[model samples]
Target chain A: MQTPSATLVSRFAMEVASACFVMAIGALVCFGAREFGIGWGDAGPQPGYFPFYVGLIIVIASCGVLVQALLQRRDRRESFLTREQGGRILAFFGPMLGFVVLSVLLGMYVALTIYLCSVMVVQGGYRFHKAAAISVATAVISYVVFEVWFLVPLLKGPLEAWLGVH
Target chain B: MENFGNLMDGFGIALSFYHLALMAAGVLLGILVGVLPGLGAPNGVSLLLPLTFTMDPVSAIILLTSMYWGALFGGSTTSILFNIPGEPSSVATTFDGYPMAQQGKATQALTLAFMSAGTGALFGVVLITALSTWVAQFALKFSSPEYFAVYLLTFASFIGMGSASPFKAVVSMMLGFACAAVGMDGVSGNVRLTFGFTALISGISFLVAVIGLFGIGELLQTMEEGLRFEGLHARINIRDVFHAIYTLPKYWVTLLRSALIGCWMGITPGGPTAASFMSYGLAKRFARNKENFGKGDPNGVIAPETADHSAGTCAILPMLALGVPGSATAAVMMGGLMIWGLTPGPMLFIERPDFVWSLIASMYLGNVMAVVLVLATVPFFAAILRIPFSIIGPMIVVVCFIGAYTIAGSTLDLWLVLPFGILGYVFKKLDYPIAPMVLAMVLGDKAEDAFRQSMIFSKGSLGIFWTNSMLVASIMTIAMLLLFWPLIGKLIGRLRRAI
Candidate 1:
C-alpha cells in the first residue's frame, strides 16, 4: 500500500488547513494592528482601530469554523478532491504557476506564446505546429489591441527592446 | 416629469450614431459572454474595462451597460435549446423551456422567452424613470455616518441572504477588506499593509482582482471539467417572430407579475437568479391552470425570463442612486464608475446629469438592441458553443492574462492573477460566496474612509452612529436582524425538516 502522503487530501483536512491558515492571517493582522496603534488618537480613531476589530473577528470566526470542522466525523465530510482529480488540477495549475515566473524572465509576449502553446500541446495533446500558430496569433493580436490601438504599454524584455519597439 | 425630460434628452445622446454602434457591438459581445460557459458579465465587463478607459464616459457606460443587457438576453437562449443554463438566472428556464423545445414548440418558446424578457426590461426602465430621481434626491441627504450605515446595510444583507455559511461570508468579506487595506493609507499617507513592497504603492487594482478571480479563476475551473458543448439546433423565421410577438398578449398577467417580482427583488438585494426563481414559483402558485405548468407551458418560460431580465436591468438603480450594488454585475459597474473618476450616488445625478440620463436612456436602447440582435444571432452563438474547451480554454486564459496585464500595465498584476485564480477556484469548490469578497474589496477602503471621517467629526465617539436618528434606526434594524440571522437559519432548517 502507498503511504499516507500519497492519499488524497480530504475535505476535513482542507477545511482544517484553511482554518489554520486564516487564523495565522488573523494573528498577523492583529500584530500589525498593534504596531499601527489600535486605540483612538487625539485626532480620531487610530489607523489600526478598524483593522484590529476586523482581525479580531477573523480570529474568532476562524476558531469557530475550525472547531466545527474538527468535530465533524471523517466519513461525514465530502471529499475535497480525490487523488486523480487532484492530479488533473495540478497538471494545469503547476504549469500556469511556472508561466508567471517564465513571463517575468522572457518578457510577457514571448512568455504568452510559450505558455499557450505548452498548455494546448502538453495538456490537451495537440500537435506542436497548431499550438505554436495559435499562440503566436494570440500574442500578436494582443499586441495590436493593447499596444497599438489602446496605446497601453505592457511589460517588455530584451527581445522586445532588441527589436527597437518601445 | 423632470426625470422624463432628462431621459428624453438622454435619448438624444444615446441615439447618436457612435453610441448606437457601440451598443450593438457591446450587446453582441455580451451575448457571446453569456452564451459561453465559464464567462459572465463580471469577467466580460472586467476584460473590456481597460478598453473602455479610452472612450468618453457616455460612450463607455453605454457600451458596458449594453453588454450587460445583452448578457441577460443571451442567458435564456441556451436554456431553451439545450437544458444548459448559460447564466445562473436562466436555470429556471430549462424546466419549461427544454420541455417546450422537446414538444417541438421551440420557436414559440424562444419567442415567448425573448418577448417576455424585453417586456420585463422595458417595464423596469419605466419604473426607473418614475422612481430613481426621488431615490437619488433622498440619497443626497446622506452624510458620512449615513454612508457608513448604508455600507453596513449592504454588507449585512450579503451575510444574511448568502447561501454560504454566514461566518464564511464574513471571512471572505474580511479577507477582501484586508486586501483593500494594502497599499497606501489615504489618511496618514502611510502604507500599512504593503509589508515593505514598493510595487504596492498604489492600492490593489480592482480591475486585476476581477479579471483574476472571475476570468482566470473561472477558466481554471472550466479546464478541470474539460467542458464540451452539445448545442441544440434552433431556427426561426420572420413568421415565427411575428407569431411569438402575437402570442405575447396572452401572457400579460404573467409578464406584469414577473416584472413586479423582478423590480422588487432588484430594488432589494435578491439579484436576478433569486428573482427568476421567485417569479417562477409565484407564477406556478398563482397560475389559473397550475396543472398545465412545467409541461411545455409558455407562461412558464415567460415568468422566469421576464423576471431575470427585469431584475438584471433594475439592479443598476441601486448602484446609480444609492452607491450600493444590488448584484455582482452592478458592483463591477460601480467599480467602472469609480475608475472613471465619477463616484456613483445621488451626487452623480446632480454633478453629471448628462452621464446619468444617457445611461438610463441607453438601458432602453440596449434592451431593444439585445432582443433584436439575440433573436437574429442565435445560430451564430450556438456555433461558437461547439468549439471544444481544449482550444477555447487556453485562449480564454490568454485573454484573462492580457486583461490582467492591462491593469496598470504591470507584470506584477499578472503574477497575482494566477494565485487569485486558484483562490477563486478553491472558494468556488468550497462553496464560498465570492460576490461579498468582491463588493467588500470595492467598498472596504471607501467604507473605512467614511468611518474615519465620521469618527473625526464625532471626536472619536462611537455614539454618533447611534445618536443620529436615521443612522440609529437603520443600523439598529440591520444589527438586530443580523444578530438573529442564525436563529432565522435554524428556524428555516427546522421548518424544512418539518415539511
Candidate 2:
C-alpha cells in the first residue's frame, strides 16, 4: 500500500531488536566467562571474574533498554529507516562486500581496479572508458604508495605471482 | 620554573627542520581527511599510525597531534561553508556559521572562528604547561586503588554527562569490556572468551573496530542520507581578516568563558563535542541578544569554535598525565603510544621527559601553524569538496580496508570490519555512544587489572575503595556521586515541590 520510500521498520522494533541482540551477546559472554571460572581465587579474582560482571551488567542494561522501548511503544512510532534508505545502504554495502571477496581472490590492486570501475559505471553513471582510466590510475597509485614506498606487503593472488611482482 | 626550563629544552628538541616539515605535512593531510566525509581525526590518525611505526616516538606524536589540530580547524570550515559538520565537534559551529555565510559574511565568520580557536588552543597549551608537573606529581603517589577509581570515574562521567540514555551508555561500555576480555588474560595466563577460535586469541583490535565504526560506518550513513555538498563559495579577503582580528578583542568575555568550559570538559572527559555544545548553550543563555544566536551572530560562531579547539587541546593533557584519554581521538593516540612501547602514565613524565616535553612544545607550535595553514588552504579544501562523492566514496572505502589490512596483515581483521561496521551504524542510529565503548576497549584490561590488584590488596573487600587513602576515597565518592547525580537531581526536585 506504500511506496518503496515508505517506512520499512519502526524505531521501536529496531530498538527492541538491538536490545535483544545485545542481551544475547551478553548471555554468550557470561557463558564463555564461566568456562574460566568466574570466582575469586588465592591470587585474587580469576580471569573471567571481571568479564562475568561486565557481561552481567550488559544484560541488565539491555533489559532496561528493552523495557523502556516496550513501555514507549505506543507513542514511539518513528521510522528507523525508509525502504529507499535501505536500498541505498545495500547498494553501497554490496560493492564493499564484493571488493573484499575479490581482494582475497585477485589481490587488492586488481580488486581495487575492478571494484572502482564497476561501481563507477554501474552506480555513478560514468562512461566505461573514464571509469577504467580512473580506476587503473588509482590502483597504480595505491600500488606505489603501499608496496613500493611503504614496503608493506598486501594480500596477493595468483595474478601477481604470474606477473613476477611480489 | 623547573617546568619552564624543561619546556625551553622541549622547544629546542621540537624546533628541528625535520620535525617542522613533518608538522606541515601532517597538518595538510589532516585537513584533507577532516574536510572529507567518512574520514575523521580518529580514523585518520589510525591510518597514519602504521606509517609512524618506523619513526621515533616524539616525532610520531608530533605528527599525529599536529594532524589533530589541523582536523579540528578543518571541521569548522565545512560547518561555515556547507552547513555540514566535517567533525562531530564542529556540529555546533554550523548553527550560526552557515547562516552567517548565507548572509554573505563568510569571510568574517571564518576569521572569527579561526581566531577564537587559536586563542582557545593557546590557553589550553598554557594550562598544560603550568599544570602538567603538578598533576604528574600528584598522580605519582596513586596506587592501584586510586588508578581504579580514576578509571571508574572516567566511565561514570560518560553516563552522568552524556546526552545519550544512561542505560544505553552502560550497554555500549560493557560491550567494549566484553570485547576487551576476549583475549588471553595477562594476569592469569589464561585465554579467555575466544570460543576456541585462533583468530580471536590475540583479541579484537581496537584499530579494526575504529576503522569499521568511524570509517566504513560513516560512509554507510552518508550513503543513506544521500549527502550533497552544496556550499557557498568562500574566499578570504585580507581586509576582512584584519577587520575580524581587530574586532576579536570585543569578544574577550565569550572567549575566556568558553576556554574555561573547554578546559573543564576536556580534563574531565566530556570531550570536544560536548564542550562545544555546552559552551554554545551557556553563551546563548547568558547573551543579551540571545535571539541573534543561530542567525548570523558572531558570538555563536566564536563560542563553539573556541570551546572545541580548547577542549581538543586540553584533552591531550589527561592522556599524558593519567593514561586516560579525554576523547575518542585521544584514545586512538594512546593506543598508538602502547604500540610504540611507551606507557602513558605519570611515570612517562619522569622516564620520558624529553618525549613528553617535546610533545607539549609541539602542541604550541602546531596550533600556530594550523591557524596560519588553515587560513591559506581554505579555498583549496573547498575545491576538494566539489569532487563528486561517487569517486571519493569508494576511494575512501579502499583506503579504510587497506588501513585495516596494514594494522596486522590479517585477512581475518578485514573480515571483522564488516560486522563492526554494521554494529557501528546501528548503534549510532540508536544513540548508543561509541566513544565510551572505544575508551573501554582501550583501557578495559588496565582498569580490570587495577581493580583486581586493589581487590587482592584488600582481600576482595570493597571497603578499601572507601576506606583507603583520602585520595582514593574522594575519587570513589566523586565517581559515585556523578553516577547517581541524575537520580539525586530528580529526588531534590520532588522534595522542593513538596515543600
Candidate 3:
C-alpha cells in the first residue's frame, strides 16, 4: 500500500469537492433569501433582494465549475497534493491543534512556552534546555508587549491565575 | 492652493515627534517582517492593526502606511542581494539585481533601488496632491446610483483584470458577501443568517478573518514546504551609497519614464507587481544599451524599483478618494479604516481632512525613512532570513493566534482562526485568489446599502442608473470596457507573443 504521505488526490476530486461545497452554501443562502422575501418593499427593496441574486450567482458559477471539473478526462487531471507533502502538513497541523487546546486550558503564555519548546525539540531536534530557554524568552517578551504595555485583556487559565499574571 | 495649505498643515502633524517615532518603528517592524519568508506588508499591517486601537486614527494610518513603504523597500534587498523576492512585485527587481550582485556590485544595486524607489514614491505623492483632491471634489456630487456604479466598477475590474477565472472570482466574492450577510441586517433590524448561534449574532469579525486567512493560513502554507530560504550575504558601505547617489541624475530619462508608468499602473489598478514587470520589460525594450540590459544594467534595477514603489504608494489615492482599494494591501488598510469607525470614501476627504492629508504627507516622509532605514540595516534584516522556517513558523502562528484572540478577547476567535486558515490554505493551493474575498467582505455591506438606496431613489426603475448624463457616461464606459474584453484579451496575447 502507498504511504499516507505519498497518497495523492486528483485535481478533479478537489475541484468537484470545492464546487459542491460552494453549491451547497449557495442553495442554503438562496433558500434563506426566498424565505426572507426577495422583493421590493414600501420603504425600499426588501433586505433579501441583494442576497437572492448573490446566492443565484454563486450556484450558477459553482455549477459551471462543477461541470468543468467533471468533464475533464482522468489523464488530464492534475495532482493536488503528494503523500509526502500531505504528511508534512499534518505534522504541523497536529501540534497546532494541540497548542490551541493547550492555550484554552493552560493560558496563552504557558501554552506558547510549551508550543515553542515542543516545536524546537520535536521538529528541529534541539536540546531541551536550549529549547526551553528560547521558548521562555519568547513567551516573556510577548507577555510584555501584548499584556503589560498594550494593556489589552487576554484569555488566560489556571496557570496565569496562579502566577497572578492576568 | 488650498490643497497646498492643507498639505502644509498635514506636514505639521506628520512631522510631529510622536508620529515620526511611530513611523520609524513601523518601518523597522515592516522591514523585519517583509524580510521574513511567507510574510509581507498586508500580513504585517493586519497583524499590527489591533495594536493601533488605542492610538488616534492619524497616527494609526501613518504607522500602517509607513509599514507599507518599509515592506516595499525591504522587498528589494532580498531581490537584489539574493534573487529572492519577498513578494511578486519585487520579482522584476531580481532580473538585473541578482546579476549585478553576482558581478559584485550588490551595494550599488541596493542603493540605486532604494533611491529610485524613493523618487517614484515622491512622484506618486505629488500625483495625490495634484489629482486626488479633484477626484474627491468630483465624487462629492455622487448619489447612491453613482456609488453603486463605482462599487460595480471595482468588482468588475477584479473579474476583468484578475488572472483567475471570472466564475471563481465571483464565487470567492459571493462567499465573502455570504459571510458579511451573517451579521445583523442594519436596515431591517433583524439579525439574519445567524442560524440562532449566540456568537453568530455579532457575525464573523473581518479582523479575525484577516488574521486567520492571512496570518495563520500563511504559516501553515509556509510549513508545508519546510525550509525554503537560501539567503545571500550583503554589505553596504558609506562609499557605495554616495557613489550610487552621485550616479543617479545620469538616468533621469529612465527614472521619469518609470515613474510615469508606475503612477499610471497604480491609479489604473494594474497593481504594483504587474507595474514592476511591465516597467522592467518596457525598460529592456527601450533602453539604449538594449544588449547590456540583462548583464548587470543599473537601469534595469531602477526601472522596476521605481515602478513598484510608485504603484504601491499611488494605490492609496483611489483607496482614499473612492473607498475602493486597488490592491490587497490597500484592502487591508481599508478594513482597518472601517474597524476604526472611519467610512473610507470621498466623504472622508471632507470629514477627516487632517487624517487624509496627514496620511498623504506621511507617505512622503515615510518613503524617505524607509530608504534611510533600509540602507543602514540591510545586513540586520538579511540575518533574519538565516533563521530556520521551522522555528519562525510556529512563532508567527503564536503571534497570529494572540492577535486573533485580542481582537475581541475571547477563545471563540482562537477557534475562528482555524477554518479560515484552512480555507486560505486551500484557496492558495487551488490558485483561487484571496484578495477578492477580503475586499468583498469589507465592501459588501456598503455596496449592498448603496444598491438598496439607489433602488429606492429610482422607485424600482432600473433605468435610474442611466438617468443622469454623468452616470450614463460612466456606466457606458464600464459597459464598453466589458464589451471589448475579448478584443483586449487578443491584443494582450499578441503583445506577449511579440515581446
Best by lDDT: 2
B1-499 in candidate 2: lDDT tens per residue?
A: 9999999999999999999998998898888888897898988998888878878999999999999998899999999999999898999999999999999999999999999999999999999999998999999999999999999999999998999888999999999999888888989889999999988989999989888988998889989998899999979898999999999999999999999999999999999999999999999999998899999899999999999999999999999999999999999999999999999999999999999999999998999999999999999999999988889999999999999989888898889999988998899999999999989999999999999999999999999998889999999999998888767878999999999
Candidate 2 at B271: error in angstroms?
A: 0.2
Candidate order (DockQ): 2, 3, 1
* Predictions' DockQ, in order: 0.52, 0.83, 0.67
Q: Candidate 1 or 2, higher TM-score?
A: 2
| Residue runs of model 1 more than 4 Å from their true location after superposition | A1-7, A70-75, B287-296, B488-499
What is model 1's native contact fraction? Answer: 0.44
lDDT of 3 by residue, B1-499 (tens): 9899999999999999999999999999888777765677777888888888888999999999999898898889888877778766898999899899898898999999999999999999999988888999888888788887877777777677767666777788888888888768877876667666778777777777777777667777767765576655788878988999999999998899999999987876667887898899899998877888778899999999999989999889989998878777898899889889998888998899999999988988998999999999998887877777778888888888888887777788899888888888787777677777887887888888888887888788877778755765576479457535645888999999999
Who wins the DockQ comparison? 2
lDDT of 3 at B109: 94
- The C-alpha RMSD of each candidate to the native structure, in angstroms, is 3.3, 1.5, 3.3
Per-residue lDDT, model 3, residue B124, is: 93
Q: CA lDDT of B428 in candidate 3? A: 73
Per-residue lDDT for A53-94 in model 3, tens only? 888899998997787666764556567777777777898888
What lDDT score belongs to each candidate, Candidate 1 first? 0.83, 0.93, 0.84
In candidate 2, residue A151 scores what lDDT?
81
Runs with alpha carbons beyond 4 Å of true place in candidate 3: A1-7, A68-77, B287-296, B483-499
